[model samples]
Target: MLLSGQSHAATESRLFLDGKELSLPEKVEIENLDGNVMIPIRVVVENLGFKVTWNQKSQSVKIEQRDKVVQLVVNDLMATVDGKQESLNAAPLLRKGSVVVPIRFVSEQMGMEVDWNNVDKVVSLITPVIEPTIKEPVKVPPTTGSGTSSPTTAPVVEPSVMLSQVNTIQFSENQLKISLSASVQPKISRLTGPDRIVLDLPNTMFSDSFRASQGLDNKLNGRLEVSGYPDVSGVRYSLFSSSPSTVRVVIDLNSAKKYTLLTETTDSTLITVQLREEDSVNIDPIVPNVPAVNDGRKKVVIDAGHGGSDPGATSISKKMEKDFTLAVALKVEQLLLQEPAIELIMTRNSDVYPTLQDRVDLANNMNADVFVSIHADSFSPTANGSQTFYYQRTNSKAFANVIHKYLIKATGFKDRGVTENGFFVIKKTKMPAVLLEVGFLSNSDNEALLFTEELQNKVAQGIVNGIKEYLGIK
Candidate 1:
């Protein structure tokens, strides 16, 4: 019923510019997925001085502003900004025959600022006059009850409240409180393998200002270990979804404990997770699951291409990219296991999809020396080759060059050569990262080779050798 209530609120979502409400076209309503707001292309694009065109043949949408051309394919998470490719967590969708795109990506790409007020289900837009400034919190009264009814044909949910901040309150050693910006009920769940509690805050957005303040080097973004703490280890939070607008807050604990949610407040809401010493018994402090290597072993995180819902590319023989990538990643893991001087981390070992943000977070949190992402290529059958890609970073090129040389030598697939592109996993990672397109799934020759265990082992060896060379290992 709460979820349904939020849905009703979303259907009546509105937009404002400098305090003035703007009229939106029909069926072209604004929707929120995860924490990002999506707006109809024609409404947002035409207003920003860009011409919008739909290519029916390609089933894609194009927006041209100034000299920039943006292309997005329906149901696909990959988009081309300028001329380079970028990954999107949420793909463009068609609702009631209208095209909608994630507003945050398009607006920022088109050079505009975006803000959201969840309580009123309103979004704000502005053009920066000088350096952008963070708006002081506008404490709006929370709306109650389901919103006005909509047509039966439309079932889309719109944006809700923004989750502005997450801060800790330490009453004493045994007591801890996690506070959220606005008053809203959130769902809580517990997990054992990692020994943590997850709080799913629906209809929420992780505030931009909080992220900027925390940046990359701070207590919020990095591991926060309070000295002499017995029950709690660290706390982490991330934007989990936009469709329902949920923000997940993860509290890493020393052991399981009873918790309580307190929403009986007029202002901010708090969730008190009891972390008393009696709750934990000889629990180990959270450490990297990676096996310990020599003192100076190079740490490498091998990210298998696509998995779960996103099968990267399919072969004529119906071989999924997910299977090939996992097979090769496992082989690479096997080869690396033979070396005592190198520690390896696999982004995934099973059939599952990890968001681009999650992959980068794992590498950065581990302080890995280098990051390698493996994938099979897609394109026309004639476009058969192996290509290594690195973003525009100094160390990225060197990593690509080393890995590509060995890969090309081993595969003997046409050398598509090393390329410079803004692929998501490579671009966001702090350490040296490269995405290796092992072979073309579109080509019969390459597909057959990729299916064989012998070739997969060779590809794995190539990656292992390149990592060794990059780390200066004999």
Candidate 2:
């Protein structure tokens, strides 16, 4: 009677209570099985002012709220509501060590309204308001009817501020703008690990149009993907809490950079976040091969294409191109480090992505003698070979020819030869640069060979030899 197999592949459903999103316990999830939205019993009932208890002996659960009581047995279609037997579309069950029950049955039986948004996979439960019943005045109130009673006024409650738009704009600088229907004091803080900037707006909710535009119905959370901007990865927003009606907005950052929050004096509904480039002094410590005073050693910058969030290509076996590129680039660095006559610089030593402009700037600012970028290509499965590319400028073609010769020999694939291409990194760099596509990741045979450590070492050695031969080093 337990759910198994492909039923677990169903998308996890989001739970909301009276329009506020409820954070589920870790490892406990809301699931849709056979079209029935199953929600964790304890999470939903407790939020609705109900007490829940488990009976291990009978494998049953009891939920109580005021004078009402509901009991459900595991894998049983029959449930008891106030001692009355009722049928269920889907029986209560255990998922990820938590008891989950059918949202509609449990919610409706407890005098709560239940709504499901199938498109967005959201389950909304609304608790009905209970108004106090008025009793007829007694005969004693007639004695005081001669004196008029003064009516007391109720306190006014302000409506929640609406978050109308969250968008990015490019003007003099890249700015993230948040539009609101009213003014709000936002709590701002910075987080690390994967760097992010978080802003919390009090008493705010997403406007109807904004929510619908995000494809969210009754769901209080969504994400916006920012394209063409190098500093930012994406933006995420959610109704963080319901008690105070707080909205949380998180900005995912690519790297550590200075940002300014612009507050409008006359218009308080608009919030602007401006991104600024990191200071040179703050940047030098993290960047490799930035010389305070050069001693005339030849500088070479090694770039490993695509990393972190950007996986360049997927191999036939599903290996990432970023991993292969970094592996070979590191091996080449190790081989080149032993030479006293050559100075080595790496675009990235770890699995992190630097923007293409960042890579070009690093080489140009360091005044590197040569620049080389490593990448794995993806095309038809039948395509297998090694190729190198260079922009049509200076001695770039000659630089590519020297590297391609060694690279083709090490890879032992069909030689694709050197070609001219206007790749961003190679074209922007001031000195001679070449982008090497070592092997076709889509080809099974080449993918298998490229992943081997022995082949990576050979490829690394070939690249070092090519750089040395090009520079007339022994």
Clashes of 1: 8
Reference-based lDDT, residue 313, model 1:
66
- Candidate 1: worst 10 consecutive residues by lDDT? 145-154
TM-score of every model? 0.41, 0.41
lDDT of 2: 0.72
The residue-by-residue lDDT of candidate 2 on 195-219, one tens digit each, is 5666666566676666665644354
- For model 1, residues 265-294, the per-residue Cα lDDT tens digits are 433455444332223444223333243255
Best by lDDT, which number? 2
Model 1 clash pairs?
Answer: 10-158, 33-242, 33-243, 34-241, 34-242, 34-243, 35-242, 118-161
List candidate 1 stretches off by more than 4 Å. Answer: 1-294
- TM-score, candidate number 1: 0.41
